[model samples]
Structures are given as C-alpha cells and as structure tokens.
Target: MNFSGKIEYWEQSTNGTWSLFAVNPSDNFSVYNFCGKFGSCNLNDNKLPCKCLPGFMPHVPQKWYSGDFSDGCTKNLMSCGDTFLNLKMMNIGRKPEQSHQVGNETECKELCLKNCDCSYTYDEKSCLIWTQELVNLQEEYVEGYNLSIRVAISDIEPTVQNCEPCGTNMIPYPLSTSSNCGDPMYFSFNCNTTSGQVSFKALGGTYRVASIYQNTSKFFIQVMDVGSLRLNQSLPFNLTTPRNSSSNVSSRVTDDVEIVWEPPLEPLCNLPADCKD
Candidate 1:
C-alpha cells in the first residue's frame, strides 16, 4: 500500500486493514542555522520563530521585520567593550571550535579573550570556546546549559550607580551586588567583607575581580581553583554575599585574566609575499 504523505508511515493490520504506524517528524527542523548567525530559533514560536540575542540588533531590520532572518544580528557599535553577558539555559546548537580542560572558569574566559576571534565560552565539565560569528543559538527553557557571550560593559543595563568600593578596588556600576550598588540583568557579583575581595559569579565557577577600568570599560579577574560548578543556580538571579564574616578565606595563586585586549580586526598581510611590500 502507498502512503499519502512522505512523513506518515502506514502498516497493514492483522485483519488486512492498513493503519497509521509511525511518523518521522524530522522534516519539521532538518536545517541547521536556519535562522542564521546570532539568530535563535524558537520552535514554540510559530509566528516569529527567530529572535536576536540580547545586546544585538538585526543586521537588516527590514529583512528581520519582514520575516527573513538570514542576515542574523550585529553587535551594537556603542556597546563595544570587554564585559560579558550570561545567557543561561540555552542550546548553542553548534560545537565550539576549541575545547580544552582548564583548571576553572576564569581560565576559560581568559583563553577565549586571548583569541581575538573567540566570540563566547561555555564551561561545564570542560571549557568550550567558540570563535567567529555564532549561529544556531536556541533558548532551551528546560535542562539547558549556561553560555557567556563576550560583550561590552555598556551593553548590560545599569541598575545601580556609584557602588560601594570592594576594599581598595572600586566596584563599578554594573558589577556590584548591594542594592545600593547593579545589573538587574543578572550580573551576579559578590563582595567579601573580611578578605575585602570582590568576586564575579558564573556557571563555570567564581573568580576574583582584579581590577575595573571605567574609562576603557575593561575588567581583570583572577581565575580560582575549580572546587564546584554551580550548574543548578537559577538564571537572572543575584548571588548573595557570604554570611561568614571571618577573615580566614584561604588564599590561592591564580592566573591573571585579561579579556579586553584583542588582535587586529584585519590581517596585516594577505599572503607571505605581501609582507615584503
């Protein structure tokens, strides 16, 4: 017997009547990066299935508004800097170009920063780094992994201003935890009262904030040992300060985290012979 449609499978019953057997629904979503770079496809959304990531605007708004998402998105020019935005519970649909087993989350961030092409970093059991334009990012509401995209500090919305200082170092507007201090967008940071050190919290782990530069919008954090991976922490939530007020916080040697520096956007030479000219 012939089936009416390609997706429906029919099998003959014992009595001789043919009935529906199984359906292969793979046709619904067979294309990868169907929404293009920086565009997230929402299977739940039928009317407008594609959306741009936070801090991103459609590369061609006209095309996006017209329901053509091939152009994807582009970073806001005014928002260029060295901070990061945490997109939790997401399906990054593509495998990273580089994967390494690092000591902790900070090392992953540092590794990505060292590569100018690196766009984002994901740390679970291993540190995963992606380079160039990212594509096929989907929001998996349930049982999804955490992703941190490199963004400018200005890209994050400001809630608290003139935050209280974290010891000798000052806590900038978007990196503070005190209500008096800010990224209502879930920029989680912790200030240690006893040790007087400020820490930045991420899915991979936590790291110490070495310094913050307001003029250039840059941050230097020190990577710590990976004791725990806080995978269960809810997204868009603040990390409460440690209750213990003692000064016995153990000190460990950490590598310096420099995420602001980047390589030249364009190659210096097209070929080896071009260098001679």
Candidate 2:
C-alpha cells in the first residue's frame, strides 16, 4: 500500500508469503527519519519519536511538540573543557568529511579534540570524524557503532582522591573504598574481605585485581567464572570479558574470567593530571 507521504513496501518471507517490508515516514522508516539537524529518532517513543541530542534543546519547542522538527535543536549550555557524549547503536547517515587511521580509540579521541572543526568521531577498525552538522541520526536496538558527540567541560564533574587497598587488591584513586573518598557517582569502589578473598564490594563475587590502566581510567579483574559479573550501581564504564589463554577448565578455571572496565572518553579531572588514580 502507498500513500501521499508514506510507502508500504513488501517482501517475500521465508515461508514464501509476501510480508510488509517497511513503512516510510512512519515510526520505522523515512528518508529523513530524525526530521532535522542534531535530532535523534527512536521508534520506541510513540508520542515523540524525535529527540534532541545531549547538551542540546529543541530549536522550536512548539514545532517539535506539533510533530514538526524541521528546525531541529540547539545547544542548551556551554562548559569549560572539551567533552563528548557517547550515543550507542546509532546510525548517522552521512560520510565524514575527514578520516584518519589511528592507533586506537584513545588516539582517535585526542586527534578529534585537537581539531576544532571535528564534531563527531567514530571508531571501529578505523577512526572517522565529521565536521559538518549531524543529520538523519537514527537509533537501533542492536548492531551499531558508538558515535561520540563533542560537548563542553563545565558539563562534566571532577574526580576525587580515593585510592585505597583492600587485601592485595589496590583500588585506584578514582575508585574509592568509601563513599567520601572518590567521586561519588563515577569513582566509587567497595571492598569486601569477609570471605578471606578480596573482591569489589559493589561486585558480588570475589575477584583479584589484575591491572589498572590509569591513563584510560580502566582496570582488569580476574575471577573464577563470568557469571559473577555484577555492579552495585550504574557508572560510565564498559565491562567486557577478555579471552582466556588456557582452554583447560580444571587447570585455569579459577583464573579464567578477566573483566576489563573502561571509563568514558572524557577525563574525570583537569588536564595535566597524574596517573595515580
């Protein structure tokens, strides 16, 4: 079925019956899904499918509420430092004006920050940076790359000093043993020694501190099984399981699981900071 502003394309299903492919200009499909610049489209939101990106507000609130987002959004506030907010599983439908082959994501971020024209940066196998206004951005539930959006420094909170050790595990500076030690939301750690094994109090199971990456604000943890992975509160970090060197379960079961936690791209402290945390 086709209409003046919408199209319903059909496709053959695996069972050999014609099925509805998609409906353009509806919730699922559109040529300009997000409506305008700096707008993000989400099909899950029925009433308001389009939303302004972080640090941004609707350019015209009345137009936006009336289901007309042609004007898009503008920045709400400005801050001191250069920061980028991560938008996961988003489809930004445009090629970046410039691209670079960097060593890693960290390097890619640094390069983007140095260039004032760069507005967005993406990292997969290579790094791609965009200088133009972002348009037609759509969110997907699964299978997408992370797009880091640049913002100001005043928006970010500073980190606190909270480096302490529980047993043999040394909790890093940003990670504290108590509530008063580190940044309350971003850098808090709990240590439990009741079981004679050192473990993160927030994380239920016992784990051994393997290594800490201060520059990246990340840490490696060794545990017996992957099932024990749990965090007491939500923080701006990505937890991933690293590959085990040994395949023998009996020989290396206790040391099989390795968890790597990565902080956000933005620094929790001011520039020229030390690696103590």
Candidate 3:
C-alpha cells in the first residue's frame, strides 16, 4: 500500500506481528550523506532536519535554506596554532582512514595535530583519525564519543596584534597576535597600533584595556566611551587560563575591575633581580 506518497509493504511473521517497511524510494534520512558532507541529520528536528557541524557554515546559504544541503558546510583555512572544536554526543559515521593505539587522550590529540591532513580525531578505546570530509554524522538518543575537529583560531574569537606595551598598559603572556608570539589560546586581546589602544574582546563589543598586574594575576578593562559593550552577567568575557597552569582564576567588578590571568611563575621570574637565590 502507498501512504503519503511512500510505497510500503506490511509483512507478518510467524509470531503474528507485522512490520511496515518502505519499498520504492525510501525516506531521505534512510540514505547516508542525506544531508551531505560536514552536515548532520537530526531526526528530532522536523522543521529543519539538516544542520552544519560546529565551526562550519553552510556552503551555500540559499540552497541550505531551501531544504537542500547538497553543498554541505565549510570551514575556514586553518593555521599552525589552530584549536579544536569538541563535538560531543556524535554518531561520527564511517571508518577512520587512519587509526592508532594511544596511551591517553593527549597522545591521541598530538598524533592528529602532527598531520596536516588530519581533520578530526576521536580517542575512545583507541585513537581514530579522519583525513577526508566527514559524512553521515547523526545524533542519536544516546551519548557517543567526543570528536575533536581542528578549526582556525580566528574563527573562535576576534584577534589583534601582540602588544608588549599598548599605549601605557603592558600585555602579558598568552596574549599575542600570531602562533609564534605567545600562547595562542589567550590571544583574545586586540591592539590598535594607530591609536596605541588595547581592547579586550567581548561577545557584544570590545572593552578598552586599562592595566595588567602580573603579581596579582589581574587585569582591568573599562568600557570604551564611544564603543558598545554587551556583557553577560554569568560569564562576563573572562579569560581562560592555560591548561598546564596551576593558577586558580578569580574575577570581580570594581569602580575599576581587575581580571585574573596567571601563567607559570617561573617564566616571569627570569630577570636577575627576580631570580636571585
């Protein structure tokens, strides 16, 4: 019988239970890459079942909006200091072209990072890496492996040139323009060479940098007189400390608020006076 333009056959087993299955052209979701590469199929989403993965944008917005995801999604060109966007609870379809046995997640990540061809990595029982475009990605009811996809740093946030001293305030570690300058993870600060002004990037707008105190692990950001700043009360655009650092970050608002960012003290104490035994 045909229902909703779909041909189906009801087959009864010996137990007297009948199963209805599609005969001719089945549902679009039944086929792999139904939503195209770098796209995911959401069975729960009736209105728009297809969406690009995080760190990706629809290749063709016009076609994507028209219920055609054939063009799929695309990512920006990545550089050496690129970071990963962790996609959790993913169905990550297809066998990995490259696989390896690793001791831990860090080892797994390092292996993928070394190879420019490695686009994504998964470290479950072992390390799994993929070089080609990801396809047939699905999000089932249950949780799945965590997949780390390499993405450009600029895509994650707004970046500016590294500043030793912007205007009057000194920029510290982990706040550089390029991968070679400082820890790229903390490259969230922007330096304006023309005006000699440094700004802290926020979701809504940029905040003028006031001062940085390495001893107290704090920095200050003031609202720019002519700029817009939309701050989230919950997060308030806090700087994330590097993973290896042992400092516990804390922030508070004052008439002039100071933010905390502490890296390993050894690097800062290299000067003769500071390093005196």
User: Could you give the C-alpha RMSD of every candidate to the true structure, in order shown?
Assistant: 18.4, 14.4, 16.6
As for candidate 2, its clashing pairs are 80-154, 81-153, 190-201
> How far does residue 185 in candidate 2 sit from its true spot (Å)?
14
Record all residue pairs in model 3 with backbone atoms less than 3 Å apart, i.e. clashing. none
lDDT of each: 0.57, 0.57, 0.58
* Residue pair clashes in candidate 1: none
- Model 3 TM-score is 0.48
TM-score of model 1 vs. true structure: 0.48
State the TM-score for model 2: 0.48
Give the range where candidate 3 is weakest over 10 consecutive residues by summed lDDT.
245-254
Error (Å) of candidate 3 at residue 139 is: 2.0
